[model samples]
Target: MPSSELFLIALATVLALPWLIWRLGRTDAWAPLVVVQILTGIALGPGLFGAAFPEIHRTVLNEEVIAMLGGVASWGVILFVWIAGTELDLSQAWRERRDSTVTAGLAMLGPLVLGGVVGMGLLWHAPGWMGPSASSWQFVAAIGMACSVTALPILILFMERLEILRKSLGQRVLRYASLDDLAIWGLLALILVDLERLGKQAAFLGLFFLATVILRRALPRLNPQDRWFLSLVWLALCALAADWAGLHYMVGAFLAGAVLEADWLDQQRLDRLREMLLLVMMPVFFLYTGLRTEWQLGGASVFAAAAALLLAGVGGKLLGLRLAGRILDWPPGQARLIGWLLQTKALIMIIFANILLDRAVISAETFTALLLMAAASTMLTIPMAQRAMKHFQDQSPEPSKLQSQR
Candidate 1:
């Protein structure tokens, strides 16, 4: 078959499976379409589909098909990260600095510490989790950050489902996640610091700072129509510079948006852009992500590792939030409710793990385990949050009413 024919088959398969499973299984409560798409990607990958239908896999997912998919996936993820960075309500976070700082700090610290300990244990028991180029500290830090991640976009979806997105609590949760998102990307840049490219990275930063100043002055003057075209050009340039600096292009994407004032672009436009990107481009990225999963450690071992990481990620998030709640004097059930919400980690964590794999900071087996942990963690979000909300309702009815009324 021609390469073009194969590419279309692969593309069709990627697009079709998600809708079919989502429609037939109706797994929205436990697994939303995004999560289902991710799972389907794994099922269709070399580890499963290729193993079961070797000839078919070879025919449809040939080298050309894979390369085409890779290009699409890369741009999809880069744009998605840029959108996330633009959505950071940092000014609002700073206005509510005390609450945001305390919560985000504790939330990040608990997972980092616990996940580091878990990484050390894994290193002792099975040393293959770290990549060939990774030092002990790099591996530990990457794993720790992975454990701490909260997928802000996915969290928004879940909150909307719970009918709390417009509520004050939902806004508060967004602030915390936004702050953590900033920290996560900052830490990633730190992790990606290559001694050989340190000069190039420094030069990139200096130039970027200068460019940001000019753009800040220029972007606001342009009509909204022109701003859209320039934004894409800026995004591409920033991503290229970041990649050249040995920081991942995704980091560059985030920085490109972060430096811009979100209000510069119309809020409706930003919302529409995000919706369209998720609706179209991000599924390709998810499928590509699934294709990268390796089962080299065997199914049982990989799953066991995933379970352990899930426990660390979820347990650490809850513990951290609980501690924060104690210090902040939150109401009896608020901590539990917020913890479950913040523990939702699907897209962002997968992106983080993919960067780790691309950098050779972690092996494919570790990436697969982290991906599983992310899916399971996200699946737990809605049901657990519902139960928490229910318990809170039962415990404090009138007060809840009064609060809601406020």
Candidate 2:
């Protein structure tokens, strides 16, 4: 069969399979369509599908076809990351700085400490887990940071599904997640720091600041449509500069969106654009991610590693939240509920692991483990949160009853 025909078949399979499974299986209560898509991507990768049928897998996902899919996936994630950055509500986080900072800080710290221990164990056991170019500290730090990530975009979707996105509690969660999102990228930048490229990186930052000031000033004068177009132009330029500076394009992508005010864009349109991107572009990224997964260290080892990381990530998050609850004097059960919600690691963690892989900070086996951990952590979120939420609501009095008592 022609490569073009094979490419179409590959695309169709990726796009169709996940939706079919999500829609037919009705996994939304636990696994959202996005999670399903991620899992599907993993299933279609060499680890599962290729392992089962090597010839067919190779034919359909040929080198040419894979490259084509990669192009789509790259742009898709870039836009998605940009949107995530642009949507950050730093002003709100600033307003509730004390609560947000404490919660976010503890939440991130717990997972980092626990996951770092696991990373160390992996390093001690075998060199296979660490990438070729990675130092001991880099490997450990990347794993630790992976556990700390909260997919801000995925968290927002979950909140919206629970019908709490606009509520006070949801807003608080968003504030905490937003602060962590900022930290995740900052740490990634630190991890990617290159002594040889230090001068270029410094120059890039200087130029970026100057350009941001000019862009911010110009944005207010332009019409809304022009603002949107110009932002895309900015996104591409920032991504290019960051990559050239030895920072990843994703670092640039996030910075591109971070400098812009969310209010400058039409919120509804931005929301729709996000939806469109997820619907169309992100699945390709997921597929691309799946294709990179390898079981070179053996399936059992990868699964065991994933299980260990998941335990560390989830257990640490809960413990941290519980401590924060005690310090903040939060009502009983509220901490656990917030902890489960924040345990979301679907998109961002995978992206973080991908960068680690690209930089050779972690091996493919480790990436696969992190990917598995992310999927499982995300799958656990909705159900655990729902139960916690129900218990919380049951414990608290209704608004009308409180009013009557008053």
Off by over 4 Å in 1: 393-406
List model 1 lDDT by residue over 95-180, tens digit each.
88999999999898888888888788778868788898889999999988999999987788788789787677887888899899
Model 2 scores a TM of: 0.96
Clash pairs detected, candidate 2:
none
Alpha carbon lDDT of each predicted model: 0.86, 0.89
Give the poorly placed runs of model 2, Cα more than 4 Å off.
394-406
**Cα lDDT of model 2 by residue, 9-60, tens digit:** 9889889999999999999988889899999999999999999999999989
Top candidate, metric lDDT: 2
Candidate 1 clashing pairs, residues 3+ apart or interchain:
none
Cand. 1 TM to true fold: 0.95
Per-residue lDDT value at 268 in model 1: 62
Q: Model 2 scores what on Cα lDDT?
A: 0.89
